[model samples]
Target: MVLPGVYAPQEDTELLAGALSDEPLPPGAAVLDVGTGTGALALEAARRGGRVTAVDVSWRAVCAARLNATRAGLPLRVRRGNLFDPVRGESFDLILTNPPYVPAPDGTRPRGPARSWDAGHDGRLVLDRICREGPELLRPGGVLLVVQSALSDPDRTLGLLRTAGLKAAVIRRRRIDFGPVLRGREHWLRHRGLLSATDDKEELVVVRAELPV
Candidate 1:
């Protein structure tokens, strides 16, 4: 169950889940789900025999994930901390994240429920961190899967991952209509030239980066 203030599983969550299902998981492979909200992805990994650990900065999210895991009868370790903080010194066979990528007008960091999607002006605040530090937390031949919006510039994500010595590319793309947040910010986005005047949909992409063995 999704707790109050915790992000609920949406299209981005399903997109990542689909990609995870296609990935061949070795028996008892170590998996890390960063920013795991309801633990949906973590549960999926556990169901596939992965030793899954999920992390989120929100206490509510951590509690929700733990409760969801217990209810699903899946083995999952849930922790509350910023990305990678709780999992330091632990490398993973696969890492998954669906971080906040919506560009916000304010440059300051977001708080409360907005933290789930109100990224900074360029929508790269959290994305950049994951691109930079996520590779270091990967085992040999480990894969990193990230879901983001087209408006956030997937090319930048690709370049950052490649620069970090990973083979990165967009593996999945889906066009979805704006949600409440984007709908409300449509005018501002258009004014900022991030969105077209007539466009009401945003393309979400799943970028897969893999480190060489």
Candidate 2:
């Protein structure tokens, strides 16, 4: 059950899951799900025979994920921490994340439910960190899959990962109408030149980055 303040699975989550499904997960592969929310992706990895570890910055999310895992009878290690803090020094075969990518009007850190999607002005506060730090946590030949909006600039994500020695590319794309958050910020986004005057949709892309063996 998703507790109050926890992010529910949305199109981005489904997109990432689709990418995960296509991946060849070996038996007992080590998997990490950052910003796990209700542990949907973590549970999916666990169901596929992966040893999954999920991390979230919110206690509500942590509790919700743990509860969901128990209900699904899946083995998921849920931890409460920011980004990679919970899994520091650990290596994983696969890392998945659907981080907060909506560009907020300000740079103040989000709290409560906003933490799930209210990324700072440029929307790269969390995304940039994931791109920079996520590579180091991957085991040789491992892959990192991230989902974010086109408004946030997927090209930068690819460049960052490639510079870190990973082969990065956009693996999936989906056009979705603006959700409540985006709709509310439509004017601000247009003011920032992130959206066209008549644009009412945003494209989400799944970026896959892999480390060489």
Candidate 3:
């Protein structure tokens, strides 16, 4: 369940969850869920027997996650802070994220509900940061699973992870109809040449990156 201001579990969440369900994680593996909204992904990892830690910058999200974990009887370490900050110096065997990838005009990060989806122009603000910093928080042989819209450039994500020495590839993809945010920005996307005038759907991609042992 999602609280006000917390990101609700939607299509992207289901896609990431499906990918997570297919993965084979070691017993008692350490898992971190960055930008975990309502603890959905973290709970999924925990359900698979991973010792889960969830982080979010929004207090409401943190509370919602904690409550969900309690109701579900899962042991989740929920932290309220920016991505990875609350778990500095910690390494996880697996990391999962469904970060904001919606392209917006302003580079200024939003503090309201928009923070859940309004990524900067090109939608690489959070994506780039995750690609750059996530490797440091992974153990050798650790895996990072991230979901993003194709409009945000999955190729760049793969390239960035590969540059960071991880073998990355798109493990899963699903085409979904445009939501309110995309609908609102459809004209802008068309004007920017990122989307065709007739495009009403976007492909969501799940990227799996594995650090070498």
Q: Indicate which candidate wins on lDDT.
A: 1
Q: Per-residue lDDT of 1-213 in model 3, one digit per residue for the tens? A: 889999999999999999899888877999999999899999988988899999999999999999999999999999998888899999999999999999997778877999999889889889999999999999999999999999999999999999999999999999999899888888889999889878879999999999999
lDDT of each: 0.95, 0.95, 0.93
Which residue runs of candidate 1 sit more than 4 Å off their true CA positions? none
* Cα RMSD for candidates in order: 0.6, 0.7, 0.8
After superposing candidate 3, which stretches have Cα over 4 Å from the reference?
none
Model 2 agreement with the true structure over 113-161: per-residue lDDT tens digits = 9989988989999999999999999999999999999999999999999
By summed lDDT, which 10 consecutive residues of candidate 3 come out lowest?
A: 102-111
Q: In candidate 1, list every pair of residues with a backbone clash.
A: none
Between candidates 2 and 3, which one is better according to TM-score?
Answer: 2
User: Looking at model 1, which ten-residue stretch has the lowest summed lDDT?
Assistant: 193-202
